[model samples]
Target: MTDPLVSLPAFREAAAERLGAFAHTTVPDSPGSRRAGVVLCVVEHEGVPSVILIKRAYRGRNAGQWGLPGGRMDEGETPEEAALRELREELGLAVGPAEVLGRLDDFPAASGFSITPVVAAPSDPGPLRPSPDEVHSVHHVSLARLAADDTPRWVPQIDGGHLLQMRLRPDWVVHAPTGAMLWQFREVVLLGREARVADFLQPDWTRN
Candidate 1:
């Protein structure tokens, strides 16, 4: 049997409902702990629900890394506010606070900042104008691709140990803490499952 078609409004409604029900965890701000907000922007592309990703312009440690469009929160700014501002700055998508579905746990990054993932949708997610100053490229990955098997994997790190990663088109490995944020969005927002992101060293899911 063929599955029924899901309209854009219906999809967004479902997402909002699921995300709102989840209790998001917060990481308290400590000395030397900065606050950064990364958006999990969802859109319907060719009838599929997709998420936006960005490749950082070659700039020190974050160069060439695929991540959500965002940056450090400005003084007195909320996480959702920062995420929406980033959507406009990075991708030219004028997303608003109303489109912000919900949020995930605060992820502690090796870079010494706590990242807050704000799940949202743009009013007009269209032809993106990426900022060369910050974005090297843009990708719209389908949510289905994220929830698929063999996507979130434990990859061998160069120095030692391993890090969690999410594989995209043609085997592009997005390493954590970006990978960790994506996984949380997939499980908590898309799949409507309980999830939490701690350190990037381990998967946050407890199902065995």
Candidate 2:
């Protein structure tokens, strides 16, 4: 059967309910470091749902990885504020406070930032211009594509294994740099399921 219509509020509520179960207690305390925020913008087109993803420029840290629109949270700026700021800075889109549905559990990066994914809806559909300073391109992939049974696989990285090793599709794969909030957004909010980071397998770029 086709999935029921998933509204922003419904998704947010589901995320909030699931947050308590997945919430992290102790964040890493490092010198000169601070909390960060991210925005997961979900937009609907012609009754079909999709999400906005950004391809970071292959120059700086985590270059060429697929991720959402987000960056570091400035002092005194709330997660919601940081999300809006990042969206405007990266995509030149103005998303207001009301558009935010709610927040999901903060995903800690191995690189050190405690990233929070803020879920929001756009006021209207319009042209999106990618800022060359940060983004390489912006594209919308259908939720249906991600939810499909066809799993993504890659070759396992080894010193001298067979040239072709089958790697299982990760439950989530938010590319580096962009810090794309992939897995949790898909399983928890969209699919209403829970997944572990270990469930995902990173691709071997050398094989590609």
Candidate 3:
């Protein structure tokens, strides 16, 4: 049988526990001309919780893959500010400062960026206008759906040169981008289970 869904407050407390103990590591591509921040907006609909995911336009790296709404952080801006800005620019959603939940662990990319994910609650909900130049589509997936039995399966990379490793499961996979946060959200917030980066292997594509 599947586990019961925990309350939102319960989830937050659990997430804090895991994030507090996470360590920071230097990314492979350290020095870069630019940096970015992303938002992993988690929302609830009629008591069922879901996460906001977006498909980037088929351009640049990791295109057409599912990810959170975010992009490069502008100069002289905090990660939180960058996250909020990205949401408005990409999704045309205006979220108030009060809606921000908290910040998650920073995950660096092989593309020379250290991304900080800011978790927030949407002030209003409805149809969203996605920036055609950057976003292809948006999906609101429930946590329960993510935890469902038929969720997408992630195949771990076998090559040794990869920096991030992951394992496929019903709800989510572990890698960079939203991987670490997803793991933390599940282990700490959802199941109250303890997990570490070493607990799972990195996917091969992250190394490239």
- Model 2 C-alpha lDDT per residue in residues 26-138, reported as the tens digit of each score: 35557855677788787775566667887788777557667788888887898889988988888888888877766666655655567778777775735687888799877
Q: After superposition, how far is residue 90 of candidate 1 from its true place, in Å?
A: 1.1
Q: What lDDT tens digits, residue by residue, belong to model 1 across residues 4-61? A: 1134565577778887788888899888778989998888777877888888887744
Question: What's the lDDT for all of these models?
Answer: 0.78, 0.61, 0.61
Model 2 spans > 4 angstroms off: 1-30, 45-47, 151-180, 196-208
Compute the lDDT of residue 163 as modeled in candidate 3.
40
The pairs that clash in candidate 1 are none
In model 1, which regions exceed 4 Å deviation? Answer: 1-7, 156-162, 202-208
* Candidate 3 C-alpha lDDT tens digits along 82-140: 98899889898887666666665566555556777776756474457899888988776
- The clash count of every prediction, one per candidate, is 0, 3, 8
The whole-model C-alpha lDDT of candidate 2 against the native structure comes to 0.61
Per-residue lDDT of 55 in model 1:
86
RMSD of each: 5.0, 5.6, 4.9
Candidate 3 residue pairs in clash (backbone atoms < 3 Å): 36-73, 164-202, 164-203, 165-201, 165-202, 165-203, 166-201, 166-202
Model 3, 98: alpha-carbon shift in Å? 1.9
Candidate 1 vs 3: which has more lDDT: 1
